[model samples]
Target chain A: MLAFVITTVLCFITYLLLTTGSGTLGLWSLEEILVGAILSLIVGSLARTIFVKDNFRMLNPVRWIIFIAYVIGPFFVAMAKANVDVAYRVITGKINPGIVKISPDLKTDFGITMLANSITLTPGTLSVDVDEDKNDLYVHWINVKKKALEKKPVNYRYVCGKFPNWIRRIAE
Target chain B: MIFNLIIYILLAIGVFFNLLAGVGLLRFPDVYTRLHAGTKCTTFGSIFICGSVILIGLRMWYTGSTDGSVLAIHTIFALVAILLTNPTGAHAIARAAHRSGVAPVRAVVDDLQNNTLKKEEEK
Candidate 1:
């Protein structure tokens, strides 16, 4: 299947990256390549379903590029801002922490997982739980802004900016 | 000299954030908040630290050291491993803590139980 091939290729690439400069052929030896190929095939066949469920969209090079951009661009910027915010909170002891729910409305499992991981990775917010049936995320927010509650639909911008949009682009 | 200076700066930022993470872990009130400090700060800090090492490797490679390329690439793999695992570990911890009935301090709402109840009723 497509999933099996993609997982094999990915596992092999990871193997190659991990074993760089170990052999003679620029980065890998002929023997190492053979070993890696055999290992990758074995692992790929066993773990293909875990990586890709029913869709191969995630295997697209475009999605990977978008994911890289997501990491280096907005995610990095947000992380910096969050580090500052958390550092300030740690210093001044001025934090109003609480849990709140947000509905990102992501359908796919990968999209939901990506959004949850992003939320957990960023400072000031931890994704405490997910409502699998309704696709709602319950996030523990460090500084739960008052406006977030009063807004027409609870501004998620207060928690994570553009994260859902990027998840949509990359995973959805 | 400039490259070294840049690498130093990156390393400094990484160390500073990691130090802040440690401080936050000590100062934060509850388990959930401490998890926040423990996970995100370290992850962000490690990314920069590994990134600086990658930079060093690239510089060496550019200077005709073949090992430099290998060093950089391996550091990248380590970075990738950290990035992939850290958040997932945090998620697992948070979920476990919640499931075990550890509530956030001063939390205004607890919808998790209510949602579960709703799902049960619907079923």
Candidate 2:
């Protein structure tokens, strides 16, 4: 119920911002504010009921701050590194191309999403698919690790590296 | 001047994110990952771009331009369309990739494939 109220308030505030403080029928009016509040309350309740599950637990605010920090920090750095690697591959055509699987230990959907998105942002690798039940991802590598590919039970430790760990920080 | 600054800032942010999506397409490791990055980032970036356009249109409307309102509203509709379709398309691509047996590197067990194969044999 409290979540509904907060959501409604936020929606109302956004409505005001988007409308640029303007009221319908030419002038700002108290009636408009009241109508906006009521409308937003209904919309917020609908949104809460539809998108948010009942069992969802709210995280500590500090955790969110940490998550954003990781997104800006390590994630960006990884993206930059991938950029260089991909650019080199594009120029030199040094790709040992093939499909490979990497099993990440991350459990949650959001964590997996973050990992997948981070991987996709990097060059020379494409996330082909995810086996949700097994928590595995199939990636098409522009440059495969020769040693890992040669070995049965490929050492994906090298392929996936610190990605899933970093993703855990941001999303899980 | 402040309005112009805000519009320009939104435009720059939108363009930057769009470039990130493009780079993501070139760099990511697999088809599914590429779709994830390409779809979500582009959608986000497009929101900002369309937002800026809306702002500019509103500003023009305020300054007595006749076409501003129509332009602003249309851009918003387009933004909504992109938001609605992009994720659904990405989900389809991911499912197709999985069905095609492009497994993740180092994955231990594939439950989806097992289930699908089971269903196939039942038929």
Candidate 3:
């Protein structure tokens, strides 16, 4: 029930965003809103179970704010730094490419997914696989540092630089 | 004039990174490294390009154009879609490559395979 409502709201918001200024009203016409509502309701009923299983905690506004802050803040900085690093490597042909395993130990599926996505999104590292039992991520790192491969307790700073912590805050 | 200049600069930077991504794709050694170049660089470049468009829309809105807000908002939706989808697609490609037996260049360990074996033994 809650999932249905959440999905409906989300879908409607997406519909509204996509259909911005298509109507006689300020943003949407009454007829368009009706059509959007019907469409969103159909979508919500269909995908509610898949989207929000039992994790209503993730629907919290605070987590969303934190996620927004993360994107605009540390993640942005990390991406810029990664772009510079990748650009240098591309220009100079200096790269030590290898795959290594890092154990993030995030329990929730959403947390693990977010971390994996973050790792893959940031340059120089691509998440190649995951150990489902132990929650370890095998990442293909473009410049494999000796410190990263020493199998030390996986430092979030070294592997993904603050991504795990931020993901924990948002999803876990 | 200043806004156009900034937008042009952003567009140039976006194009530059995209060009570097193409260069890296050709020059990099293997599948994994090539994926890095192909995915992240384009994503970053697209971000800047979309951002410049959003700026243009905002400037138009400030000049009393009603269509500007709609343009800006829709561009944001596109940006969000790109940001969300690109990395996941890259991850899928990387995982598929690894599963299909594409090893990294000069890799020292295969912990993923080791862990899978360990799990199988435990079962």
Cα RMSD to the true fold for all candidates: 2.3, 7.0, 2.1
The two-chain DockQ for each candidate, comma-separated, is: 0.70, 0.15, 0.68
Which candidate do you rate higher for DockQ, 1 or 2? 1
The lDDT-based order of candidates, best leading, equals 1, 3, 2
Residue by residue across B13-112, what tens digits does model 3's lDDT show?
A: 9998899899999988888888888888888899999989999999987997768888899889899889889888888888888777677876655566
Assess the local accuracy of residue A99 in candidate 2 as a C-alpha lDDT between 0 and 100: 59
Q: After superposition, which runs of candidate 3 have C-alpha atoms over 4 Å from their true positions?
A: A152-156, B113-123
Per-prediction TM-score, please?
A: 0.91, 0.58, 0.93
lDDT of 2 at A45: 80
lDDT of 2 by residue, A23-57 (tens): 44543357767778889978988886654455333
Tally clashes: model 3.
0
lDDT of 1 by residue, B1-123 (tens): 998999999999899989999999999999888888888899889988998999999998889877887999989888888987887888888888887778788776555656656766898
Please give, as one word, the docking class of candidate 3: medium
lDDT of 3 by residue, A7-28 (tens): 9999999888777667769867
When only the first chain is scored, the TM-scores of the models are 0.92, 0.74, 0.93
Cα lDDT for residue A153, candidate 2: 38
The list of candidate 1 runs beyond 4 A from truth reads A151-155, B116-123
TM-score of candidate 2 versus the correct structure, residues matched by position: 0.58
